[model samples]
Target: MADLRVELCGVSLKNPVIPASGTFGFGREYNEIYDIARLGAVATKGLTLLPRPGNPVPRIAESRGVILNAVGLQNPGVESFIKNDLEWLRSKTKVIANVAGSTIAEYGEICARLDGLVDFIELNISCPNVKCGGMAFGVRPESIREVTAEAKKNCPHTPLIVKLSPNAESIPLNARAAEEGGADCLSLVNTFTGLAIDIERRRPILANNTGGVSGAGIKPIAVRMVYEAARAVKIPVVGMGGIACAEDAVEFLTAGAAAVQVGTANFGDTRACLKIIEGLNEWCDRHGVSKVSDLTGTLVPNA
Candidate 1:
């Protein structure tokens, strides 16, 4: 057997498989189906200081190999999570609290509240900074640095993982920006901005008009972007976009992801993360590798 354990920002994970935020939902519902403790970590749904009802119906739409979503960061709020789900989730595995907000102060406030409470705090930079005319904080390198710095100042205890948006002008530049802002770690390629249309009705499919695109179809592009981001930064990168199987994850590892998060796969299979974990063990054994960490940045490119 091979050693599957890996470390992220000084924290030990049994493996490199963490379920991405938005898809896992705090790991409660899935815990009923499988032992979610098998995962390296569970990134909770995007949390805010207050609960959000989310976008209107038609929030989720399906297509070929990808899906579009504009769920609007719906959640039960930070206080509700601490009071109800925190303990139970902590009992299972390491917790990665994913947080979002409408302003830098809101991000700082929420980070302060979660400090020392979870193993890691992942700043979701996708949310719009309302004060900036509703422009998302993750679109440019400047905003990424600003929001990450603000959040890190408030989270003196827990390590801050800035989750980068894929819709940026330059991913590597943004990755470097997050690093310069004092981010302990980084996770990316958050869903890409995409549009799906109802041809017959001549209307947008999702109520929000446009949605974040994710799934197997985006894996190739995601892999390339992950490679770009990982190569440009000294900080560890948690690559996530359209991973569905172990092989897909191995590609990310080869491209230089220290860890990988499984997202859309969970919506289809309850035990997708576990299955990928098992597959990682087998692949490592077959490759005569000792530790899975050895596979990071192992890809050999042709001249």
Candidate 2:
């Protein structure tokens, strides 16, 4: 069997497949289907300093090959998560705490609170559908640097990962900024800002009017952006967007991602992550690849 183990910022993962934040939701629900410990890591839903009720109704809208979400950052406060979900999840597998805030100070507060409690603290700076500080800090390279630095300072014991937004001016620039600001790792292409309209109603499907777009439709663009950002930064990059299967996961690896995150696919199939993991093993065995990590950054540019 091929070796599927990979490391991110010195933390070793059993494999490179992680359930993206917001999609896996602390792994309790999924645990009913399979052992959560079988996967590489579980990224918790976006956590805030205080509990958030999120946005209004019709938060999720489906379209051809993709989905739009304005779910906001609806999550139990960090305190509740620490008390409720933290240890249970940690015992299952590696825990990556996905956190968000409405202010730069709040980012530090949450990071500090979760410091040493989770394996990784993923800073959610690129949520497009939110009305507050999410996308605001992610759009510019300057703020990406500033907010990342603040979060990193607060969480010295845990690895800090800055999740970059696809709605930014330049993926490479924002990636470099996070690297400069002390991000131990980077994850990208967090949903593109998109709008879906109801033809008969002549109104946007989501109550927020606009939402972050994700799913299979964003794969190509996500792969390209991942390639660009990976080339720009020295730190490890975790690629995500529209990944659905093992082949999709391999594409991100070839594009320079140390690992990949599965998001919307989980909505359609509960076993998507596990299937991808099994598929990866099969694919590697068939291709004669001894270690899956060898596939990273193996893309050869067209001459």
Candidate 3:
């Protein structure tokens, strides 16, 4: 048997196969399909200070090998999650509360609300700030630092994992900004900004016009960004983009990710994470690798 455990920011996971935020929901629905305990951790849907109804109809549309979603961070508010879902989720497996907010105060307050309650607090700066005229806090490195710092200040007891947006001008720069702002760990390659048009209607498929893209089509680009951010930051990097199988997860590990998050694949196969875990073990055994962590950043350049 191979060792599959991974430790990030002092939290030890049974394995490195976490489910990305917004994709896994609160875990109750998926738990009906498979044991939620089987996962390393579950990054819950992006939560805010207040609940959001999300965008209009047609928020999700499928591309050739990818998916575009402008769910608009729709989720139950932070207080509701604490009052209803927090304890049950913690009892099942590790919890990474994925948080989103419009202002620095909102971020701090939500983090404070979740502080000392969950296993980790994942700061999500990707959602648009209505007050800022629809600008996402994540697109700018400066805002990334500011938001990370504020959230860190409030969530002093829990480790902070800042999720970076791929839409940024420089991923590594934003990663460094997070570290500078006191991020204990970082997760990257959040869905890319994309859109699809309906030829017949001659309009955007998504009601919001633009949406975040994810799935197998994004694997290579995500791997590249993971490599860049990993090299630039001292903190651990949790990579996720288009990982659908064990080999795909290994690619991110080799690209310098401390762990990998399984996203859109879960939509297709409810048991995707479990299968990927099995695949990781099989691959490790076949390659004579004793520990999965040994594969991190093990990629060799072509001679």
Candidate 4:
């Protein structure tokens, strides 16, 4: 058997498979299906300083190979998470608190509150900056840096991970910017902006009109972007996009992700992360790889 352990930003993960935020929903429902402790870590849904009702209904839509969502970061707020879910989740496995904010100050405040309470603070900078005319903080490298810095400053005791937005103008530049802002780790690519039309009504399928696209259809593009971001940064990168199986996880690791997060795959099969973990063990042994950590950046490019 091969060793599946891998370290992300000095934090040890038994494996490199974490359930992505939003998709896993604090791992409570999934825990009823399987032992979530068997996995690497669980990233909580995007938490804000206060609770949000999220976007209107019909926020989720389905296409052939992917799904679209404009859920709008609905959550019970950071205090609620800390008071209710935090301790229980930490008892099972590493807890990565995914946080978002409407302003840079709010990011700092939330991070300060969650400082040493969680193993890591994953910043979801994709939220619109209400103070800045509703521009997403992750859209620009400058804002990515600013928000990352603010969050990092407040969470000095915990590792700060800047989750990159795929919809940004320059992923590599943004990755570097996050690094420059003192991000201990990084995760990407959040979701690609896409629209689904309901031809029957000649209108949009999702009530939000457009939604973030995710699923198996995004693996190739995500892999390429992960490779680019990883190559451009010294900090560890957590790759996620449309990973559904173990092979998909391996592709991200080899492409330069120190860890991989399973997202939409969780919706298809509740045990997707576990199955991927099992598949990885079998794959490593079959390939004669001793440690899974050795798989990072192992991709051989065609010259």
Residues 223-251, candidate 4: write the lDDT tens digits. Answer: 99999999999999999999999999999
Compared with the true structure, what per-residue lDDT tens digits does model 2 show for residues 1-303? 899999999999999999999998889999999999999999999999899999999999999999999999889899999999998999999999999999999999999999999999999999886778999999899999999999999999999999999988889899999999999999987999999999999999999999989999999999999999999999999999899999999999999999999999999999999999999999999999999999999999999
What is the RMSD of candidate 1?
A: 1.7
* Candidate number with greatest TM-score: 2
lDDT of 3 by residue, 133-243 (tens): 123778788888888999999999999999888888998899999999999998987888887999999999988888888999999999999999999988999999999
Clashes of each: 0, 0, 0, 0
Candidate 1 residue pairs that clash: none
Model 1, span 6-117: residue lDDT tens: 9999999999999999999988789899999899999999998999888887988898999998888889999999999999999999999999888889999999999999
Off by over 4 Å in 3: 128-135
* Residue pairs whose backbone atoms clash in candidate 4: none
Clashes of 3: 0
TM-score of each model, paired residue for residue: 0.97, 0.99, 0.97, 0.97
To one decimal, what is the Cα RMSD in angstroms of model 4 from the true structure? Answer: 1.6
TM-score for candidate 2, residues paired by index: 0.99
- In candidate 3, the residue pairs with backbone N, CA or C atoms under 3 Å apart (3 or more residues apart, or in different chains) clash, namely none
Who wins the lDDT comparison?
2
lDDT of the candidates, in the order given: 0.89, 0.94, 0.89, 0.91
lDDT at 162 for candidate 3? 91
The TM-score of predicted model 1 comes to: 0.97
